[model samples]
Target chain A: MIALSINWHAEDQAWLLVAQNRRGLPFGIGGSQLVAGGALLALSAPMAGRVASWAAVNPHDPTPLLRPPAWDDAVVAAAILGAALLLALLSRWTERLGLRTMLEMRSEEGREPLVGPVSVTLGPDRATIRGATWEASYDAALLTGIEEPPGYLILRFGAARPVMLPRRDLTEPDAAAVRDWAAGVLGHDDAAP
Target chain B: MNEVSSGTPPRRPWERPVTPPSARPAGLWTSPAPDRGPVLVVRVDTEDEVAASRLAVAAMTPRGGLGSAALGGLVMLTAVTAVLASGSGWKSPVPEGLPLLAILAAIAAFAGLGWLAGAYLLPLVRRWASVAHARRVLRPGPDGVPPDGGGPARVVLGTRALHWTGPRAARRFDVALLRGLVEDRDHMMLRFGLVSVVVLPRRDLAPEQQEAVRDWVRRHAREGRA
Candidate 1:
């Protein structure tokens, strides 16, 4: 068994990304923006056309177009667009906040580290993770895939919470060995000969 | 050792269990029941249908009931505003010299009201639809079978999978693929993957059977966590 210690940080963006992906954000950031922008344009196009028509009819009298009421449509459109943008940002912030709160509660205010400074023992076909209050053994054959994202290794099992192992705690050779072992267990072509 | 020498071929990992006719659970006829363990049969009714529809919608929209309603209201408001603007000969609806803040506030208030109204009303509409669907599908005949000849609607729970036989179709949900199991006051929702759910009403189940179902869910959930 290859045993390694992990200094887990719950505040990591990698974890956030994993959490967000698992929960699944409908429309996502760019998609939401696109939908909001498209709706704004669609809602405002009629108003724009109407203004153009008014201008065409009363070309001489620019006074009506300059009135405050004339800009009501624009104001409403801008407000809606603003609300949409604000909502997008708020949703992202809320998710992160909620994740932090959940972690805090689970870890009991840092008295117990849910994933912090945990010891992991990698067997030929399974990995045993020991936390402060809990220990879980995961079968490597059941793992869907292994994600190597920058300085972390994420073990993904279908419908189960992924296990994140930071590479900083392990020696380079050890990290490589773990990755190759996982790859081999998962039947990936990149596994070492 | 020769190519011709063969007993029954070894079962593949993904092959479904071939339950014998004698061991098949009662009230299930569409296919062979999973022979993993004891089977629990739960009958379907209008309430179960309604709950299923509600749960399905909830699963589809992860933002919860209020958020989904609010979003719907916003979209509807935008469409309505556009239509009215076009109909009113392009004239501004606001009075002259109206403050931008006031206009924004009024719009926000309208959206909020719409959201509340939708949140209240959408469930009623869903319930009505579900009731109608149940009437059509689960309408019992004099012989206790469906008039449409599709047979009785029921869900058979096994250790390895869930078999749901509706009025017109049957679905098999493998236990390994189930994402979560949620039990509320009236229904037990078996969530498969993300959006698929099987709602089993507890009204027809005996207390001991209900406990058995709970125990099964608990055991599987723990295994899944492990």
Candidate 2:
């Protein structure tokens, strides 16, 4: 079994599932970054060359994507690496800030691709769920909307895709507590798997 | 009423006629293919009531659903990097080693994006696989059942046969048998233990074809009413 670091929490009144390919703690994380960089370097090298060629052809336009301005491969690689880092940082930071208002969830308008013992938790009606998906709700009514899903449950809006809530693994009565609450909302029953 | 040569032939996965003679319902009906209202036979299994309700609610949700982790993950990955770079002085402390951090950031971002993308893609693939696999398991549509297989002219299931297959692995019920992986949430599943239905004229099916299928299933089998 591939070991992935997954954390389950609540963000924006929704559940979140997070997984990364990092092994161990502390320094191992730093190594993971290097792996990511290697991938980026592999991708950007070709892109850099393509950009340089594009520059030769389209001399007038912005022509920014075409290769780096330096002669040394390392220099060009650094520039690309730097850009990827900045983008990654910016994307991550921006994604976090997005949790507050959830202005545009277009990026999150789908299902997660994980198959395993997913985790779960109950948040204050208005609490935001913290996982691969970041949703916040304002009331307990959100729980009512919960339904059994293929893998996990998201319960953000009307009739969304099914999700596998960790509750199923719980004993009948325990699971029923949550299931009953949810059934009241979706207006259906799912007492069993 | 307008009756235009309506009747369908019987069909099933097994070579033997799976449709029960006693399963016929008294009423009008329609065909899966428009204008081909031929008489058809279908075998529906009755599932457990509690389980049926559970499965129905579960089915109502499409498949491979995602919650709010997308945004949360994006925020967390950024926070980790920023706190390190800005607080620890890694952001601009040394340009050389900074490359490593940057590389890490990209992976985090891609992984997050990939996770969300998988949610959508996985379900779609799983659904297709289930339908195809179901077709394979119940070969009557191909083998004994003619290409012009018969459909339920009108099916009315009884309450005693509402059993869901509960994800059978060909031989018996298992979580792996269901619309699995993406669709089954890693659990093999098949529905039907106890259920009941009453088949009726399908031409009267107002909305979706899925409704027609349900109508057929209901007619064939159902849970014993409480």
Candidate 3:
């Protein structure tokens, strides 16, 4: 299992914590910390022997931002690319550290109160949110498939996505505990899945 | 509130006096008054949204920041790449000025495209932000249900923070840069990719759930402010 984290803060800033794994495949996650409404909406890794082929016609152009701002449009431009490459590098670094690639890795552990499956359980005294199946614990389970339903939370993305939980019955505190704990674990933003 | 001759009068209790659009504020800005009239409310925890939608995400990925900067950088990168690929010392047939200039022009176009992409996709992000906020201030309102519509079998992964509900007024959300999307009783139609969102009423949610719902509405308005 690989252990790494990425943080996408507001004001257009991002950070990555990359550490190599044993499978010769890197492992890591990336998203936003700030600007709660907008986070990493997409992520992908080519199948076996597909990267080189994809790179052949790779449409990505790493041109530099030449705009000269009074303060730092250029600085921001550089940071933009810097963040992208950093995310990419961190992924590779995780591989070098022997961690499996996110596409290949699965989570099996995380904080407690999380039993298994997906659903939002609310009963007499509890609130709990359950995560999905993965070989790695919370440390390596890069959350994917994030959505917004202008219906919950404080961010302005309008959405009404249903909750995910495993327990058929739950306590009131379990529901509240899950809600509070999940927010704390996932942070205020939708960076992690 | 004056009743519109036609549609259902969905006005909230606090929105007796409506504010004119002209009196609104300017740029990346939120209205001084959080309470325009009444607020839209909802309450769902891990129970309503079955784990069906849950997925893993990194703690803090710079996707939003990247989207913001993409306009500035993507253009330049594509242009430079085109110029280099045109190779000054190659048996290439493409001309120098035309190809280089074309690349520059393409850069400009790509930049615009990036901005457009960011604008259109924000609402989807905003929708999730509500759930994120709900997770933070998790509390069953009156009943032990998730929220009203959420029943008792939903799942919640996290939250951003719930905002207090504003009075009757025009709450907004930025669909894109400088773009304002109002979600009041008048225009409650939710248009998503080719589908419409069926939003429920606030009464359905528990008290705590109601707060979460109000926060979601306020946040939706705030997204536009950004």
Candidate 4:
């Protein structure tokens, strides 16, 4: 089996920032809807008066008399506001579920980085990583994906924190070997030449 | 000495030398400074500010399903309310002229709310305002010097911190405190904390300098842990 070992870190900050931003999304949506609904409710009466005066001035016109129902207007506004609130709640619940999954995966303390460098061994079909106090192995099929962002190669597993391998510390051959192994396992065509 | 022993284990592929070949060398504008170590000075212009403004707007914009749905719902409801109030005639408890006043009020309210929510007008206004501000603040005087007695608008990357000095603004942030680095096709945003961010145009830096910046962050992160 083709295997390689390297020091790696967890991209904790990026994960945290993303989670923080996601947490605010539902609130932003709900608040905007509330303001819009309230404004519409407040303006319903005056709008009725304007249409009435315009009809009276054009008495000779053949247009039918139009009547605005305040109660119906209020109901429509409330219904839309309620729908928005429901969507926001649904979004919040989904975010929480994702967060819970991530937290559960993170409960495996051995997967996290220790004060010293963590050792990661990447093989053809599986990988083993060990910190100061614990060790774990993950099947290649279970990994979600791999991303090459600038200076680091990130191995993602669902919503969990990604394993980041700094490219600067790897030999070109070692990096190529790891990339090829991952590409083969993940069924990707972008393996290093 | 005549003991049967297994021969030395075959060398593993990963046991090879770890040092990678050096990246291609590129020229950078650097100068010596007093206590800050080697400083890389990057000139800023209107184009850079425009890129930064675009990045800021993108960062502020919401993403994903629900956030977009909510924004869409807001717009739809606003339109529905305006149509119902203006076109339909409702029996008013008050006066006939008041309905016209209500329609005007509704329009004003929706416009204000949309701007505050950053759903429509705010981003456009912010982009325009930022570009205008950049033009005024980054404008150099006749001698190519800033009018506020500070140097021309430039971003200085130092060993310890990143410094941004313009005619109206001077800010310094420690490199070690950098929380995250987010990048797009055209720009990179260096996030210092939850609220503070420095957007830099990617075209301003050479490939080597970009790598150097990433190396600096990785080195500091390790050192901080130590």
**DockQ measured for candidate 4:** 0.02
TM-scores of the candidates, chain A only = 0.62, 0.26, 0.19, 0.43
Q: Predicted chain A of model 1: TM-score relative to the true chain A?
A: 0.62
RMSD of 3: 19.4
- i-RMS for every candidate (Å) is 15.5, 21.1, 19.8, 17.8
Q: So what's the TM-score on candidate 3?
A: 0.26
Report the TM-score of the second chain of model 4 against its true counterpart.
Answer: 0.41
Question: Per-residue lDDT for A191 in model 4?
Answer: 50
Candidate 3 local lDDT, A1-193, one digit each (tens): 1111211111111011121011122222222222222222111111101221222222242222222233343444455555665665554443333322221121222211112233332222222222231111111011212222232221111122223222223345544554554454346345634
TM-score against truth, every candidate: 0.43, 0.24, 0.26, 0.30
Question: What DockQ does each candidate score versus the true complex, computed on alpha carbons?
Answer: 0.01, 0.02, 0.04, 0.02
For model 4, state the Cα shift of residue B194 in Å: 6.6
Tens digit per residue, CA lDDT, model 1, A96-186: 6655665555344433334367777777766666554334444555455677778777775432235677777778988888887777776
Candidate 4's residue-wise lDDT over B1-226, tens digit each?
1222445564322122222113311111011222232233355444554455445544544533344334433453455455556754445454667555654544455444434444543344445544444454344433343222333434555555555544333345555445555577876666553334566667666665666556655654422311
Error of 4 at B6 (Å): 35
Candidate 2: fraction of native contacts reproduced: 0.00
Query: Could you give candidate 3's per-residue lDDT for residues B41-154 as a string of tens digits?
Result: 433343333211211121112234346446434545643554356552122343435444444455555455445455545434533543354343333433332422232211
lDDT (Cα atoms) of all candidates against the true structure: 0.51, 0.32, 0.29, 0.47
lDDT of 2 by residue, A20-48 (tens): 11112221222223335444454445443
